[model samples]
Target: MVEINSLDENDVLFGVVASDRKNRWLGMHVDHDQTPPLPWWMSNPNQMPQWTNFLPGESNNHEYHGETRVQMRKPTGKWNDVPCDKKLKCICEININ
Candidate 1:
């Protein structure tokens, strides 16, 4: 997936080359830049760094884009393995009784 700062025509074009998207919706593209950091009370006393996604040795279609994947938070409060390039939010809520 291509994660861009904003949605544009290029997203559609890239999707076509990514995989077989035959009349299927991939879902909305969102970027969550307001994720809260770890609270001080339960934080590490020693040196701590912000959450980041990195590929120790993963492959990507883009040659220049290596390692250093973007962070994605899912509805379940879990980090999802999505292309850091695609500007999309991972969340889905359905009420049930």
Candidate 2:
């Protein structure tokens, strides 16, 4: 099991592949089991939207090297996904349970 950490608005997440999601909204799907966004002093706790690049059985962008961006963080620090082809800085959190 893996969870991509959430970021606050204006919070920068490095190393992300650029994605061309329609309207630049980022590829998204309804995932009921995804973790909630992190809560900070100024961050809102009510907006933990779950999103993913790959939509199974759905047509999607197959651009660059990575058509499906597995893990990504938006510059706004919100939950988002990007193209896996673009290379950029990113952070990973590993927890042992």
Candidate 3:
């Protein structure tokens, strides 16, 4: 998996290599000019940080890319480790009924 600031072919290639080396997706290539350290709120020592939960009124749109191996975000803005295709990107919906 890989994450880039923008979807450029070159950036995606680099991110893939970096992800393979680290065995996890590093959102935004570390070589980016303005790459920032992972925030304290997202830190996890056991495994890659999985995006979960949503603050009230948070925007529904996101620019994230690459494999969804770790978490899948629901339309309601809650993320969980639901199994899905390990593709470049995907959207999963569940019927509450």
Clashes of each: 6, 5, 0
Q: Total clashes, candidate 3?
A: 0
* TM-score of every prediction relative to native: 0.20, 0.28, 0.21
Q: Give residue 41's lDDT in candidate 1 (0 to 100).
A: 10
lDDT of 1 by residue, 8-35 (tens): 4324433543453222212222222213
Which clashing pairs does model 3 show? none
Model 3 lDDT tens row, 15-92: 444444422222211111223322111123334234323234222223343212333132222222212243334322
- Clash pairs for candidate 2: 7-77, 14-89, 14-90, 15-88, 15-89
- Model 2 CA deviation exceeding 4 Å by range: 5-66, 70-74
lDDT tens per residue, model 2, 11-97: 232323234221222323223223331211112335443432323422223342333333333432333334545554444334559
State the TM-score for model 3.
0.21
Question: RMSD per prediction, one decimal?
Answer: 14.0, 11.3, 15.7
Query: How accurate locally is residue 3 in candidate 2, as Cα lDDT from 0 to 100?
Result: 37
RMSD, model 3, all Cα superposed? 15.7
Cα lDDT, model 1, residue 39: 12
